[model samples]
Target chain A: MNIFNYELKINLKSSLYYLLGMIALTSLYLTFFPSFSKDTSAFINLLEGFPPEFQNAFGIDLKNILSIMGFYAFILFYILLISSIQGMNLGVSILSKEERDKTADFLMTKPVTRSKILISKLGASITIVLITNLLFYLVSYMSINLIIEDTFSFKVFTLLHLSVFLVEMIFLSIGFFIGVFLKKVKSTISISLAVVFSFFAIGAFAVNASDDKMRYLTPFKYFDTNYILKNGTYELSYLVVGIVLIILCLVGSYFIYVNKDIDSV
Target chain B: MASNIIEMKNLTKYYGKARGIIDITFNIKEGEIFGFIGPNGAGKSTTIRTLLNLIHPTSGESTIFGLDTTKYPAKIAEEVGYIPSEIFYYDNMKVKELLKYSASFYKKDSKKRMAELVDIMELDVNRKIRDLSLGNKKKVSIIQGLMHEPRLVILDEPTSGLDPLMQQRFFDLIMEENKKGTTVLFSSHILNEVQKISTRVGIVKEGKLIKLEDMNTLREKTYKRVLIESSTPIDDNYFNIKGTKDFKTVDDKLSFLYSGDINLLTNKLSTLKVHDLLIEDPDLEDIFMHYYVREE
Candidate 1:
């Protein structure tokens, strides 16, 4: 509990920066939607002018482009991108920071087991991610409500927000696995960005491929915003896969960390 | 009866193909300060780290307080305090915060003891860890390791960054802890430092513990550095005595290492026109070299 509290205190400021960045970007993007709807046809024609591959890759869905929720789905692409980076950055840095900062000897020599340390750090990171997603949901929902007089389905709106959390969880788990898997990672941000963007690039390719098998390769494809907007629910199969991956990564990390030989700095 | 506080039985560790320590075995009795002495890369840190359970052994086992170290490290750690050679803490935390966090690991309330150590070490608790110098950080390490008042204390090259005055104070602190039945396992390549505090010493070289003996016994068996200033030019063969090696002469001065009978050297010196004679105990490095050369 002391370690948990300490972790929370140490991470609080950085987590706030991520939240603020998300809020500012999401709110700024939502404000542009009111004007974007006024010129909806022009925007649609302009989107249509691009190659079909480019449109599909960028998630430019003309059918839902005019509506507020549809506009949010378009904006969800960027939101999820930023959210995943934040989650990945948090997951990668938390566990490895003790070693990278050369404080492992101090912490490891204490009476607590390595598993307890991992749990505290993981718990603190999840709490930060949870807080970020909750604030992002409120800010996005409020901004959308203020801009559009036409009512949107509250259920669909919630489903969209929930997918962001789900996607962030996947990235966070993968980031954690990477952190534990490597002997050392000098720069957590660079590693996080590279990993998150690689998966995102895979998602872009999966968009064009639209292959059922390829969707499993990328977390971005796991929560299809279009599918969520239509069915008002997450795909059960992908949700199960996401949960399984998270469990596997976390469990593997615990085993590796507990059994690891903490070499001197 | 004093029990073995620590026992390593045929313990071995290999980092892939590189050797850490091999077939190492020793025991430290309760309330004794056992010095671990070795030059750089002599596996002193490896053996200490294995005992602390920071690194697992490749084969065999080690136990502290009669409990297997690998299986019950956290349990063992409750009564053990370890200070590594290089000290590092969370840079963002103040000294007091880090000390409090360390204290939380123990079931015992260490607030009073923590305050006492802070005052003894003359540490400013309000300062951030990053703002501290190397020696100050080491002072924090010392306090944190001792604040818990653990039954077993392990220190590795603990005096490196300290000034002579602080080192003396630190030794006094350890001696105080030892008086309370704390068993200390002190490791260092600095021979004289260990000689000052240790009751017994273990010498390691090239991944093996080569010698373990009582401190007095080791001192008895080691050589003395002898320097003689003569009134006459000394003959090269004049002092060709047994157990004398590395003999050298420059003008009217002569110096050599002597390990044999003190009476025989004194008799030979009396016959010569000796102006002045000085004999001193050789440093640990010389004694260590003697052991290595003897082994080879």
Candidate 2:
């Protein structure tokens, strides 16, 4: 318990920095877009002026751009983009750093089990991502409340942030899986980026495609920002699927880490 | 009731198809300083890693404190302190921070232990690990390994970066630890250092334990160089003594590598017109080279 807390303490600073940076960037972007905080019709008009292909590529829908929920549609996709990269960097670097630095041998010689060491690292990574997402939520909420004077549903804002949090956790879990399977640090980072981007591309295509079947194929399509904007809620089935995938990925990571041949210092 | 702290029975390790170590078997008694001596790529590190349970053995078994290495690795690790040949710490961590992080694993007064080790090793804890010199970094590694005062200390090439004075100081520390009943297992290619502290020496070559014996016994059994200056050219047949392994004749001098009783060498020399004879006792280097060359 003390060791785990010690590990957490060491990582807390980096986690806070990442969180604060994300919040700062998001706030700056929101503050710059004056139309987004002012007239909803102007925001909708601005989104509609873009080419349909461009809007689809960015996972933005012009139809719901005027609604209170439409703001969430824009924010969710952007949050996923930032959070996935952050999560992947944190996960892929954790264990591989020990090997890259030639400290695995020394750490392995301690009385702790492999599982225990991994658990502590995993716990730290998760805690960091969660704290970052929480800060993002708080910052986004305050920005929306302070900047937008018009009446907007607070429930939509809550649901949007909650869905984003779930998506971030899923990416974090996938990143953990990547870390366990890859040996070299460079390869791990590269593979994690490829996997995350591929998923994002698949999700974008699924959202834009005319075929209804394509929607089920991508996790991103499940949390349709357009649907969330119109209904003020996330799709329950998609939420369940995302939760299941996260659990499976986490379990797979543990299995790989437990049996894999760990190199010494 | 043998006080064996470690025992290996025909242990072997393979990295894919390449053999890392083959059929290595040895035992180290409690409080003994056992030196694992070998040349580069001789599988010294492989055997040490296997004993520490850092890598799994391909065959046979190893037990530390009578507990199976694989089955009870955590238990064994709790009592064992390990110093790797190449010591590396996180780049951004201060020396003091790294020590504190490592010390957190053991149930001990980490701060007090850290202070004592810092004093003994004469290391600056405030400096970032990346900023330290190779010798200073190595000192930090040594301090981390010994701070917990484990029952068994496993150090691979522990004094590689230390200067002669520091090496002597390290020897003194090891001797002092041994006096307090700590079993030290150190591997090194430097034969002289191994000979200075080791009670028993295990010579590894080509992934095998070619020689394991008491340090004194190995010293006694190793081939002695006999350089003889003869009044008359001695016949090549005179060099074919029973214990001699290799014989070389140069001008008036005949040199024979004697692996047997010195008495037999003396008798052989008595038969020749030996004006002057020099018998050089084999040091660890000679013993290591003899076996390594013979194996090759």
TM-score of model 2 (CA atoms):
0.87
Question: What is candidate 2's lDDT per residue for A83-166, written digit by digit as tens?
Answer: 777777677767666776677777788888888888888888887777777777887788767766656777777777777777
Give DockQ: model 2.
0.55
Model 2 spans > 4 angstroms off: A32-46, A187-191, A212-218, B110-113, B224-244, B248-296
True A-B contacts kept by model 1: 0.76
Candidate 2, B76-175: lDDT as tens digits:
8877888888888777889988888888788766677668778988888899999999999889888888888889999899998899999899899889
What lDDT is reached at residue A61 by model 1?
81
True contacts kept of each: 0.76, 0.73
Per-candidate clashes, comma-separated:
0, 1
Q: Candidate 2, which CAPRI tier?
A: medium
Query: Which one is best on TM-score?
Result: 1
